[model samples]
Target: MTASHTPRAKSADTVSALERGLAVLRSFSEDRPQLGHAELVRLTGIPRPTVTRLVATLVGAGMLKPAPVADRFMLGPGVVSLARVFLGSLDVRGVARPYLQSLAEEVGVSTYLAVRDGMEMVIIEACRPRTSMLAARLDVGSRAPLPVSALGRAFLSAVDEPQRQQLIDSLRLQRGPEWDSVAPAMHRAIAEARDLGYCLSLGEFHREINSVSVALIGPSGEVMALNCGGAAFMFTEQRLREELAPRLRTIAQAIAHAIGGHLPALP
Candidate 1:
């Protein structure tokens, strides 16, 4: 099922104003959390004059604030208010946080809980060990692309065949020529996930990272996924497949039970 907050447009005639506004908001990320007007123009490809007005409107709405370090802007309290409202409307996070946190600590890695949003997976919860030997740079609001992430492959495996094909078809259009080359590998990965109850990604997206993920039906009847991973050197492919995958699958089962979700049994 689709996420409630996922963007949608019924037709090509839909208003461009909201999309452009969101594009401006999305230009900020963990890597570039603050940006100046020029940087925003470069990032969003919205012309300088248009972006200037957009920035002004956002600032006026209290959605963007001036940065202390430089002549940049960071997302303001209004974004946090929006996030708070969205999170408060869901019980899954409250039910899953402690379990995910304990599991992350036990495994000494990063753990994530995410749901499909358009062609990507939006992280709803993420945890990292308090004293991790290796750092995995991910936060609750991070978005993982569908083509290359273990979270995405695991999610693809959990959905019905018809829906999966439909998504792939849409991806072909969205991702262009890259999807043609990536499809074979992704199909193999999804099938492997179906057999193993979890999917593995060894530097498929980020060369320095390796990950394992399992998708399950969420309490709200929407699909959600769990991911566990860290830096490549910290966990060998053999170790991830032989050891960590089982532990994650066990946690996936517990999460499934806790939230009235479906997690497949290992075959």
Candidate 2:
């Protein structure tokens, strides 16, 4: 029932090095950046030596760097460089990049490529709109709570029923630090998204940003998602409901088709 145990069981079944490296990277976040060897060991639950080795490797690779005047370390400049490389190499991103760019240009907002990571969605790629005041605001490697994000809900809605149910069950237990409005609102939003073929997050993740997302499924039925977000003041809820949702669905459909997903019948 513990968060660590649940994901550990699932990850152990797969045992991917890439996944482990990501785990290590995710261990360092806003709440706990600049970890020493002992903190890293406890956070990742990996052996101290192994964590040290991984930290060393990451530091050498530029994914991590030693802190200015402390033994603790933080994310290195190499992360952005590697992220650019990773984004450049993804065939899905490459194919969808032009469309996302066009969408950002047309709508004058920011767009993101969201991929599932355990029970969360990570923003792997993003395109900023030139006209928006929030252009280049969200960091590329940012993480979002699945149950609270339009992109995460869109990905969930695209999945098969049984998996969706299981995922929902897990998320039901993993609500954010605050337990009030965010949790109940997400439940309603997801249900609405299931009916509409796209999801919307209106100022839940941020006070001033509104986001709309649609799924981009793969040939093998894997679910990814695309998100478009902007200042809520500039792109009001009414405008998003009327204009952005339809545009997101169209782009998501094209990306899904390019990646070999059957287009879902719109409701």
Best model number under lDDT: 1
On the 0 to 100 scale, the lDDT of residue 109 in model 2 is: 88
Clashing pairs in 1: none
lDDT at 94 for candidate 1?
81
RMSD of each: 4.4, 3.7
**With candidate 1 superimposed using the best TM-score fit, by how many Å does residue 130's alpha carbon deviate from the native?**
2.6
Candidate 1 ranges beyond 4 A from true positions = 1-14, 36-49, 68-71, 161-163, 173-181, 264-267
lDDT of 2 by residue, 1-267 (tens): 222312254544586555556667777766576878877766666767877788888899899999975789998898878777877767787777788889899889899888887777878778876677864366566777777778777777777789888887776665545546566777777677778877888877777889988876678766788888898888888888899888888888888778777555557
Model 2 spans with C-alpha error above 4 angstroms: 1-7, 10-22, 30-33, 38-42, 45-64, 75-89, 176-181
